[model samples]
Structures are given as structure tokens and as C-alpha cells.
Target: MPNIFTQNLGETPRQALNWRLGYAILCFGLMGASRGIDEGLISGTVQQKAFISKYRLNDPLLSESERANLLGNITAMVQIGSIGGALLAFLITDKIGRLWATRQLCLIWIAGIIIFITSNGRIGQVYAGRFIAGLGIGQTAVVAPTYLAEISPRAIRGLCICAFSGSVYLGIMLSYFSSWGSALHISSHSQNQWIVPTSLHLMFAGIILLLSIGVHESPRFLASKGKKEEATATMSKIRNLPEDHPYVQTEMLDIFEQVEREKEATMGLGWIGPLKELFMTPSNRYRIMLGLMSQLLAQWSGANSITIYAPTFFAMLGTTGQSEKLFATAIFGVVKLVASLVCALFLVDMLGRKRALTYGIILQFLSMLYVAIYLAIVPEITEHFQPMGNAKRAGTAAIVAIYISGVGWALGWNSIQYLINAEIFPLRVRALGSSMVMCFHFANQYGNSKAVPSMLLETAMKPQGTFFFFAAVTLLGLIWMWFFLPETAGKSLEAMDEMFNLPWYVIGRKGAALTASAGHAENYMRDDVEKVIQHEVSHDEQVTSSEK
Candidate 1:
């Protein structure tokens, strides 16, 4: 696999990249499918004629603004619920551990989907079900990445983490095709059109839960809880090595040392310790700020809005009918999925996080600028305006621009937003910090998802203005990332502290360079482990002589 992906395997042990580790990552990575399916499913589900008729979403009597508000409310409810879910995820992940957390969230997700499918014609039930589902779906953002980072080897950490990100597009693609297939074969009047596709939520959640049963809890999490022997055993099993193997010993020592340091730093602080460390410590405060800003910039960049409302956006771009719009959206999903896979398999580990982000954001900015300019120049397609000659060519270009934006998004913000938060913090506050980050993630997502419907209206930002806003945000994000986002590729979880120890202004720009020159913790730990092993061997021999 490493040969195929062309990942620089670095100095990582061959045993650490074994099948057990891969299976665990696969189980957790699929959690991203929960959010992906929801985002893709809802957009097409709402566009169904039966759904519109049953829910009266397109009622003739409702004003355009009112109808837009309703659509926004319906689409954004899960994100609203996700805010609360993310806020509480740290508590759940901390209390029960990652494996149990996966189980619980899956159950919650399944229950929510059941309620949603049985809603009949009740819009309130639809909202309630989706919001409930969001509770479970939201936790995936925090849990999967944290687990993946904690369990993975440093050399391929980016690849492992991006696996989760990539699965998001996999889910989106499957949901898009399911919706398109249902629209083609199922009767428009039948509720089965949307319900059948909605069942995908249940399928993915169930699969994740089942697969997780065989996976081990994160060894770092175990170490944090003072379960040293168990942590060593788990680490050995995951890495496919003996407990005394140099790789296993060095990695465990790193975890133990970090745990001890954190224990001292927050000894008397009790439950507030992690929170205090997160907010009061200068480095952690900076980390939290980065986490928040990543989400803020990513959500507002307009790529996510394009994803959630692909059909609507296609219609505005002059795709003529529902079938054509759905087909275009499905193709859009395909583009995103392929791009995300490329990021996961090649770009992330090979290019490094900062460079990957830089390149991706550049692509996003160019694409969004093209779309915004085209929309500004062309007559409004939603007003029954049809293009010909040069106008038609420009519209075609705009459609291509939208697809390029998805590619850029999958490569950049979509991967980093989850990866950065998961890897940046110390293990002590990893869950808490990730939870806080995802809380803001969902909050900003809710704002973007809800506002986009109205933002596309003539009375508000309009299609052109809204895209212009996205293009501007994308440009700002590119600048922010260049100056602030450090390269985190091939760095161990324990090595992150030294990476951020520089002055805030210089850290993002120069931190990676400093960390590289300073020597990695893994190298230091390996030297230390050899000395400890020799000392223990000598002591055992001395004891043997005394007994003889």
C-alpha cells in the first residue's frame, strides 16, 4: 500500500503499519460518512416533488422570503443540533473512551434516522429526527480524527487522518447516486423516493458500530488514564510488535512522559484543568484560536455551501431540469470524492499539510473568482434567462469552476479543518479542545447552511454577491494559512508541543523549520529507551548472581 501511494514511510517501524492498525482506521474513518450522507441526502430529499408536496415547501401562498426561511430551517436543523453534540462530545469521549463513544453515537444516529423516516408528512418530526441524528453525527468530527491521530504512526498520520476526511466524500457520492437513482426509478408521489435514500444513514452508522467492536481503544487515551500495562499491550497489538520492541517501548515512553507532564501541570485543577490549560496557556490558546478560525474560514469559503445545495446551484448555472440538475450534482459529488481520495492517498503525506492547504486554497480562490465573475456578468438564469453563444460558453465555464472549487475544497479546508484540530493539542486536552473546535465548526456550519438559502435570494446577497463573498473569504483563508498554518506532516503527537513553542507570529511561518532542526522527540526517545533497556538487563543479571 505504501509503495502504491508513494508515501515517504520515513523512519516508522514496518510493524506499526500492519493490518490491525489499518482495520482500526477504516472503522473509525467511516464515521465521516454520517455527516456526508446527511449533507448530500437532505439537499436532494427536499427537492423531491413528494417531499415538497407533503411538507408544502413550495406552497403558492407563502412569500418567497418565507419559503426561503423554511427551507433554510429545514436544512440547517442538523447543524443546529450538532452544535450541542460537539459541545458534549468531550465529556462522552473522555468518560467512556473512543470505542464506546462510537457505539453510543451510532445508536443515537440510528434512532434519529428511524424517527426521520417515519415522519410521514410532519415537518416538525423531520426537523426533530435530523436534529437528533446531528447529535450523533457531530461527535464523529471530534472522535474519529482524535482516534486516528492517537493510533497512527507519525509518518502516515496525515494519510490516516485524511482517510476519515475522504470517507466524507464517499458518503456524499453514495447519497447523491442514491437520490439520483430513486428519482429515476421511484414514483414522484411515493414517500419511498426520499425514505429509501435516507436509510443510508442507518446503513453506514450500523457498519461503523459493528466494525468498531473488534478495534482497540486508543493507546494514548489508555496511557492518560494511568493504565500503563494495558496501554503497552494495546500498543503492541496495534503495532503488531512485542511490548519490549524498541518501536513499542519508545512510543509508549513518549505517551507516558507526556501524560506525566500534563498530570503535573493540571494536578490540582481537577475537572477544570483541561479547560484552564486550553484557554489560559498561551500555546493552547493559540491552538484553540487556530481551530476556531479553521472552521470559520472553511465554512464561509462557500465550498460547503456549494456541496449542500449543488442542485440549486446547478439550476442557477443554467442546468435546465431536475434530472439535469441532479445529474450535475451527482457528477459534482464524483469530482469531490476523487479529489478527497487524491488528498488522502497522495497529496497530504507527500506534499505536507501546509503546502497541500496552500495549493488547494489557491485552486479554490481561482475557481470561486471565476464563478463570481461569471454570475455577475451573465443575466440571472433563475429569472428564466437563457444564454446563447458567448453567454452559453461562460455558463459552461462557471459550471466547470464550481467543480474545481469542490476539488480544491476536498484538498484544502475539508481535510485540514478536521486534521488540524485533532493533532494540534496535547493529549490531556485533545478531546476537550477538539470538542470546542467542532462546536464552533457546527455553529459556523449552521450559520452558513441556513444563511445560504436566503443569501442566494435577490433581496439579499443574490447568487453573484454570495459567490463573491465566498471568493473573498477563500482569498483571506489562503493568506491566513500561509502566515499561520505550520507543516505538521511526519510529526508525532508528543512532538506537537515543540512545534508551537515559538512566538505566535513566527510559529506558523518558521515553526516547522525550527522543529526539523531541533531534532524530533522520537529520535531522543529511541536513544533513551536503549539506555533504559541496558540498565534493566544489567540489574536482572546482578539479581540472578545474588540468588545463585
Candidate 2:
């Protein structure tokens, strides 16, 4: 209707939400929703194990080792598919536009869902469905964050990028609650046991595919492909402004100049350009390496471990009944979902990245330590089957500790990793860079997901040892994050290179503090943008003089 973009350009980008930005968020959020739904379905497996067993996945005729292996494969199938899918996304994200790649992934997700709906408990069919769906999940992981990052204005980019993670946690909570609800009414042996949970994934995937049809292609992608006019038009449309709008013009010029500089820097490198730019450049490599490390540690933050095995974790908290386990797991999911939403919307941009991470990790370590200590003290009452006197109190404390741990995880590692992945890299290699990081993420998640079950049953350390192990890992993660993680809130994507190129000592401060000390970082960014545009202007003038 009326031009909201014109009025908003005068306001801070963070405070303004034009129709285009709203549209972008809506599209990206839907993609995030599907991811959340898929995660909920997969993690629902913890509750659906009996359904899986009824399907003969854990057939008694098979040897114990055979059953364990099959069960392990089924659990890890999505992660395995995700790993492969990330590799594929890495190779093709730049070739096809982000929108196109996402469209393709939606199709894969739909196909996977159809396979699951019709599998009829055939193990091969079940694995095939998960694996196929995983391919879509893997690609979505890279593309969605990258898309949101590219489209968002720097002032609100952290919050916008965080929508992806927030929606994911929302989906996880939805799955937990929905599965718990279904568990109350349906028999474990009923055909609906698996069908109801798996159907949610199909419904979400279909919604994502339908919504994606209206999404505009990323302006950065268009510019990178040498379509300047189209890139400018897309940027204007996305910003809800005319092409001549000063804000739109400035934004377009900045992107073009940065893209040009990248091209000049990597001239003659040919097909290996993006890869070389990512790893061979010292600053870029460090940023990506840190991103990879963050992702790896994020998986180990014990959040995914809890989500995938919340029912088991509840059992250890002195809740043995199936209904009790489901109810507890659902509550844990609710805590995480609430914490994640609050942190994503308020804390991420408010506390700045480093402080949020530090505080979150600190609390996380304490929560895990509480678990380890409680379990170590009461080793006799294994699996919450018998809680006598102090044991009952200890179990109650452990359950509370689990809820606190979910809150800690939601506030910090869960949302921060994706934001870092989106913000750290440049346009040329952003897709490849993000894909590489996510590959490590999915791999570690797969390992942790598989390891949790084995840690509880097979390890000599038992469940007590597993809690101790995670607590120890959480401590290490805390140290690693404090030293290596930089505060990146409010910095533009184009300015990342200059920002990272600064000394490590300076990079450690809060983004606002850094900006204050740097004589207004926005001015610095504007100056840099002007210099690039000026260079092009002077070169044209010189050519004209020479010809005359």
C-alpha cells in the first residue's frame, strides 16, 4: 500500500519491519518451521522406540549385537543423510541460487515423507525415508541461515538470523508435547503410533514447499552472478523501496563493490575460487575455523543429546513410568522452547554475542555438574526405579537440573552457533563455508546421538559416567568459547572482513564497545563503502582522460 520503506529508512533498521522484510522473515520462518518439525519427528523416536520394535526393527530373533547395530543405524540414519546432504549443498549452493536449492530440498523432503507414510514398518523403507528426508534437512540447514543472513539489514540481522533457530526449538517443543499427547491416548502397538508422528513431518514439509513459491531470490546471489540490474531491482523490492531510494542505492553499491573486490582478489583461480578464498586467506580461514569449532561444540553442549534422549534422561531422574517419562520430556522441551524464544528475540542482540555465550555456557556447565554429582552419589537407584529417602530428593534435584540445563542451552549455544555461521563468512564462499561448518555439526550430532545410548548401556562408566563426561566437555566448551568467540552484533556482512582483520584483543569486546572505541563503526563502514565506489569513479575518469 503506502510506501513503508520510505518512512522506515529514516529510522534504525533494527526497529523497522517493512512489508518486504516481513515477507522475507515469513518465508524463512516457514523454512525454519519445517526444520523444527523434522527434528521433532526424528527426536520423537525416543518415545517411539516401542513402535520401532513392534515394526521388527529390534526383532528378538536377531542377536543382541545385530539388534543394537540395526537400532543404532536407524537412530543415526538422519544424521548420516544430513552429512551427505551437506556435502551436496556445499557443492551446488553457489551453482544454483539459494531459493532454487531450497525448492529442490523441499521436494526431497516431501518424497521422504511419502516413503515413511507407506513404509509399513519395513526396515529398509523406514531407513530410506529418514535418509531421504535427511538430505533435505541437511541442505536446509545451510541455505536457510545463509538466506536469512543475506537478506537481513545489519542492525537486526542477529535477531532475524536467529528466527531460524527459534523456530527449530519451537518445532522440537511441539514434537515433544504432541508425542506426549498421543502417547496418552494411543496404544504403543497401534499403527498410529509411528504414523501420527511421522505424518507431522509430511505436513510441515508441504507447507514449506508451498510458501517457498513466493520467496524472492537473494539479491546478493543475483549480483554475484553478474546480473546487476536484476540485483538492484531485487534489493529495492526486498527493502520495500524504489530503485532510486538512497538507502537502496547505498546498499546495492556496497554489495557490488565488495563482490568486485572479492573477484579481483581471486582472479584467475577459476573453479577453485570459492574454496581458496575460504581456506587460503588467513582471516577468512580463521573465521571459518572458529565457526566449525563453534558448531562442533554446540552439538556437544548436551542440548541435542538431551532432546534426542530426553525420555532416557527423565528415566535417570527417577521417573520410570512411560507416561511420566513422556510428560517430563515434554516439559523439558517446553523449557527449552521458551528459553530459546526469549534469547533469540531479546538476549542475542541485547547482551551481544560473546556475553550471551559466556553466561549461557557458565550456567550450562553448572547444570551438568549438578547431574554428574547427584548420579555419582546415588548409583544404587539406577533408572529412577527406586528412590528411597535422600535418593528421592537427589532425583528431584536432578530433574530440576535437567530443566535448568535446557534453559542454559537455549540461551546460548543453540542459537549462537547458527548466527555465527551466518555472519562470519563472505558472499563468495558463504554457502561453502556454512556447508562445511554444518557438515561438522551434523557429524558431531550424529556421534553424540549415537553415543548417548551406548554411554548409558554399554560403558563401564554407566549413566553416571556419561553425565560426568558431558560436564567435562561443557567446561572445555566454555573455555574455548571465551577465548575464540568474538562479538559480532550490529556489524554488516560486508564489514566482516575488516572486522576480523582487526587484532584479536580488540575483537573480544562487545560490539557496542568496539564501535564506540572505533569512532562510530557505522561511519567506518560508510567510509569503506565510499572508498570502493570512489575507486571505480577515479578509474573511469582516468580512462576518459587517457582517451582524450
TM-score of each: 0.95, 0.90
Query: What lDDT tens digits, residue by residue, belong to model 1 across residues 307-335?
Result: 88999999888997777888899999999
For model 2, what is the C-alpha lDDT against the true structure? 0.76
Top-lDDT candidate index: 1
Determine which window of 10 residues in candidate 2 has minimal summed lDDT: 2-11
Q: Count the clashes in each prediction.
A: 0, 1
lDDT digits (tens) for residues 432-473 of candidate 2:
889999889889988877776666764345777888888888
lDDT of each: 0.88, 0.76
